[model samples]
Target chain A: MSVTYAAVQWNRQKKLYDSVIAGGVALYLGRFVGVGAMVHPQATAETLLIRGLGTAAFLLLHVVLSIGPLTRLDRRFLPLLYNRRHLGVTMFTLALGHGVFSLVQFHALGDVPPLVSLLTAPARFEQLGLAALTILFLMAATSHDFWLKLLTPPGWKRLHMLVYLAYALLVAHVSLGALQSERNPLFVGVVLTGACVVLGLHVAAWGAGRGYVEVCEVERIGENRAVLLKLGDEKIAVFRHGGKVSAISNVCAHQGGPLSEGKIVDGCVTCPWHGYQYLPETGASPPPFTEKVAVYETKVEGGKVLVSRCAKTSSI
Target chain B: MQWAEGLTTMLGVYGAAGAVFAALFLWKGVAHVDAGARGAGIGFRAVIAAGCVALWPLLAAKWVRR
Candidate 1:
């Protein structure tokens, strides 16, 4: 859905910065405590707790890493902008926790074998947990806005896309390690679903360009709000609004939000992804001058709605 | 040993703090469309917050038991 001015009015860049700072402080302070000597009911319980911490920490990082591409195509995905730093801080703390806890619980006893195990383990080790952590380590170190600003947009995107590597690593790590634990199956399923959804949204968004073009079926979804059918490589719902119902590129340019899934209000379609309102006629974003989206041409033919890939210049 | 306990407790607290921040941010965003791009970010933070919150009591309870 196209973004209207009312939607973008809630800029939270300042709030995002504050959250990041706060999260960093908490993680920083926690780092010392995680490594320090503590009270434990049993050494065994301590070991398990630390291991859990390690796993959870990695999971948090993975979640943070996945947020980028997700926000790119979807305008509503912007809220994460305010809280990304906090997420980063949380991941950092987790990685630190995992590292410290592991060091303390498994290696402190001078158990040289367990200490060496991470390095000496078979190729599978490198392919799994170790690899994931390595990617995360790189990402964490570069996470500061300073690095992001230094790196060009494309550069930042290329470097950060390593998240795919991290994601693959986490999947393997969990499949190989976590699955062995009780209730891990449930957790694994959720993780897998999440990965799929993010990936799926991306594919759908990208498909808007590469997908097959075929008019699936012409149907009236509402009064004077007719939808031109698409069912080829991509699924599009061309909304017919009054004043020459503008043909938006069917897919919510934002996160490929299903325009069909959104509602038509005030002669505009509102995206459910983030409630972006777009005038169906121009596809030009109103109010929120920040975002300008593509506008597609349309024509009503033989009582069937037809949308074009070429942009339309006629304004509403 | 005390460090380890302190670390986990802080990690949980950190998780909760991040969540509260996100929930508040998203609560406002849920009202608009520009907030959509960050939906994953908010949802993920909420999950982290919830996970941390859910496990926090258990971690604290275990400590109390000891």
Candidate 2:
């Protein structure tokens, strides 16, 4: 939709999204600080900041990760996907705060630079935390549309998938670091439950689309739109364009966006996720770009369109 | 403990270097693919470049596939 670049594309939805994020962060911090002070009156300010920010960021990350599979499971979660960048940036900021405070508290007095200290620290989980922080930094920096436009949707999405790795690293970070020293079973339980929920949701969402080779009439697939067909674990998009019918992988070659939701643009099937386009006939991008999606064979039988259960490579 | 410690340190060193390389690749790869992308301001492009760096592996995979 954005053909031109702007410094900042502000809108009502973005304003509301940012406000809710800010309010949620403030409320989370207040509650965390209040509870921490009560449980351990002797805890210092630095400890409180580290604990609060780290935990909050971890929780936010769980939410951020959940949004994808949740949306796949139910379309109601699409609203969260629209402004997910803000959620990510806010989470990264909280993580940065935690990293900075931890550095100052534990490594500032040391002779080595904080970066060096962080790398060489004797702590077991420092590396994991550092890795997670680095990934978050990349995600935050490229959260803008400018990057998306340049990176192309597929490239940008591929890059953002590093979030899964970052999440794993962070779980290890907590497990090896604070979780190790903290004796409270409740805290451990919460961490475990969070990881379980994230993992469980992903598993369920993935399974939801499996086990069905849905058959739909070609006539039912409206012009310029796609019908999403699930063939076991694979989701295929059957499109009818200009009196021709073709089927392609529902997964956007970039970022795994639902190609079924995308419309045909300029004779190519466009991905709604980031506007990457592929030819409906061959599932290949137009000349000069090498992006391609798996193409499926479709046959007409008795005045009905039948999409194949497996993908057949189209010669483009 | 010794083996674990060594493995962790090795991952840290490699991971740091990998991050830098990935970011650089994303920046260049995106610009290469999209002609209009290079027209953007340097600051904004640099940010995108960092994202590429962060996701170098995925970008690399897609780049080779293309």
List all candidate RMSDs to the true structure.
16.5, 8.2
Candidate 2's docking class is incorrect
Q: Which residues of candidate 1, in runs, are more than 4 Å off?
A: A1-45, A69-74, A82-86, A111-115, A122-127, A149-151, A208-316, B1-66
What proportion of the true contacts does each candidate reproduce?
Answer: 0.00, 0.23
**Residues A131-226, candidate 1, lDDT per residue (tens digit)?**
666566556555544234335455656877887787777777766665655364677787777678767766765655342233323445454353
Clashes of 1: 32
DockQ leader? 2
DockQ of each: 0.02, 0.19
Query: Residues A1-316, candidate 2, lDDT per residue (tens digit)?
Result: 2243433466998899889999999999999898999998999977997999999999999999999889878878888999998899899999999999998888789776566677777886987998899899988987888667647777778889999999999989999998889978997999899999999999988787443244677788889998888764678888988887889998776788899999999999999989999999889988898888899888766656777655677322
Name the regions of candidate 2 deviating beyond 4 angstroms: A211-213, A216-246, A249-281, A285-316, B1-66
* Count of backbone collisions within predicted model 2: 3
Report the number of clashing residue pairs per model.
32, 3
Taking all chains together, each candidate's TM-score versus the true structure is 0.43, 0.67
